[model samples]
Target: HVTLVPSHPSYAVISENKRQVRYQAPIHQPLVKVKYFYGVLGSPSITSGKHYWEVDVSNKRDWILGVCVSLKCNEKWNFLRPENYQPKNGYWVIGLRYANNYCASQDAVKYSDFQDSSRSTPSAPWVVPLFMTIFPNRVGVFLDCEACTVSFFDVTNNGFLIYKFSNCHFSYPVFPYFSPMTCELPMTLCSPSS
Candidate 1:
């Protein structure tokens, strides 16, 4: 996620309307050992309270939406692989792929299990597959820091709940995540009135 508060992203192009971000091609091997795609994070990260945002995904099929838990990921990894994103890796996100497949990034183990005295391995990614009856034109992301939950709504279907992540341990401030994916379509950030 790009921290607009600090600086703008170099790999993604923001439209003149300032609502859409189209990521550019990958720079030959990035600072990290791997090559990852570009994505954006909204400014003024949420430390508390509830926050909601919507993305216009009417024409997009491959994308990712949710909240990112680690601001440090930008400084450390610079860019992250989608496969590395999980609750344990400081990302609570849902993704769409292959035009129809939907899934949420989950942890193989519970959060509290690691906090115990035993030094076990970190949580592995447990992607839960999701099936939607209707493809939403706009997806609403709601983050409740107090409840430690993030929920996604299908705005096109009377705000129906698509999926929700519970008992999230947000270590850092949460930032709204947007990944338009490598598709030809662009994802637009929706205004409150729209």
Candidate 2:
């Protein structure tokens, strides 16, 4: 079994056992700054080979799970911004919002010239819907460094594929990331076999 690290409390409120984390303030709370509720990265970044991990998000209202570049404790980045979750920023994630929508982040594309096939336009990164399903109690993440792929599975449903990010460019070591947004329920890291 691999060890899983919870998010740092400075970025979010981590549980005593380091198995769960939550944003301190709710979205409707007054004077609550979004910057105070950033997500956390797991320890022991993956350098090569295949690795798998699972997170228990049962009864959680909002959360995000996936892999990201290992950021130092002292390093500063605006994770609260929407653009920070894109591949260009070293974040490839799938998340469930309060409205029960599941989506994957992707870079936006546009056709600069309608008549010309070669001309294309670049826009901000955005998310695309994968499907509409109830959030799984336990989500499994499989990362294949050599294959440049990251896949998520619904552990509660016969290990069904939730989403997969293929052809990912890994310039640096990456780690598992988790964010339980404003939900009191803990997000526990589960054994891959479980």
Candidate 3:
């Protein structure tokens, strides 16, 4: 996904030769100290099979879709904070915050026990809100590294299966991550029809 992320340096208004990105509001950047601004687009790492992708987010309002663990193997965590968007330091996301508030993030993982694997202690980032009635204009991300899970879908409401980040603790090689959260529309990345 065109990686050039120096700790996301506020995404530099998102353009490293453009794959259609527009949505600013996190400017004022000049090396690290950013408190709350989002941008990360990473791909190519998967580690297994059963992969799928889609994202049009029609009339988008804020976005983020799952799978992480790449900044060349977690650069010692601190990818510019959202508390480190997490599933034990390697994120497995799901977002659409502040426009309708369809949230799901719980850094380092823990919140009613993110699927309860004997509640293996680790906490600090929790945003869980997801109570959808189906309003996903297009989003179908499914990664199953031998069933360690990372599923999110609504692909315009018929493929609805919106919240699922179960028991995932992949120790390296995980990709496909995005965050189009400021809005000028067009967070397009659709390639899943075959």
Candidate 4:
């Protein structure tokens, strides 16, 4: 499963207004990377906490056999420590496409649940919890198992596929996405479409 940590733990508080609601957060850029055994493709497009990339369809779209991505929440993710949460907010989220078409032809692609019971627990069950922090905001994929295809992933809500992985491949595409920034407690996330 993917691990999500807010950019700033405490300061990310949501405020409500009849006409509008605001969630203020200290602005600090997040470091992002996409990784797999195939190797690191490139840095991701950063927007808020979400990232993006394109799998080019120029010449070798069919060579891609499998795909996966890695996300680093931030080192300050430890801010959860004071809150009595596990210290692992960064991890890999792997998505496998066994079928030849693999939803590329379908109007909506659905991924299986993110939790796999067969894998060993990293530290504890409830260490870190947040849909935005864990799953890739969206996953855009284009593939041609025989030729070549460009796949796209958007890790944002309603934007892309959400996946759960059973293993952690932390070598090439792994690094903390954000650095420590002072945060305030008692915060709430604002609904995207609110």
The whole-model lDDT of each prediction reads 0.73, 0.72, 0.66, 0.26
Better of 2 and 4 by TM-score: 2
Which portions of model 1 show Cα errors greater than 4 Å?
1-10, 26-35, 76-78, 109-124
For candidate 4, lDDT tens digit of each residue in 33-126? 3111111112232212222232211111111211222343344332322111111333232222221112211111112234565654333323
The clash count of every prediction, one per candidate, is 1, 0, 1, 28
Worst 10 residues of 2 by lDDT: 71-80
Q: How far off is residue 97 in model 4, in Å? A: 5.3
Considering only N, C-alpha and C atoms within 3 Å, which residue pairs clash in candidate 3?
A: 107-125
Residue 41 in candidate 2 has what lDDT? 74
Error of 3 at 51 (Å): 11
Sorted by TM-score (best first), the order is 2, 1, 3, 4
Stretches of candidate 4 off by over 4 Å are 1-36, 44-50, 56-89, 97-138, 141-194
Worst 10 residues of 3 by lDDT: 1-10
lDDT score for residue 178 of model 3: 70
Error of 4 at 18 (Å): 48
Model 1 whole-model lDDT (C-alpha atoms)? 0.73
Per-prediction TM-score:
0.79, 0.81, 0.28, 0.21
- 63-133 in candidate 3: lDDT tens per residue? 76677777434433323457667777678887886668888786644433567676565545777888888
Distance from true location, Cα of 132 in model 1, Å: 0.6
Total backbone clashes of candidate 1, pairs 3 or more residues apart or in separate chains: 1
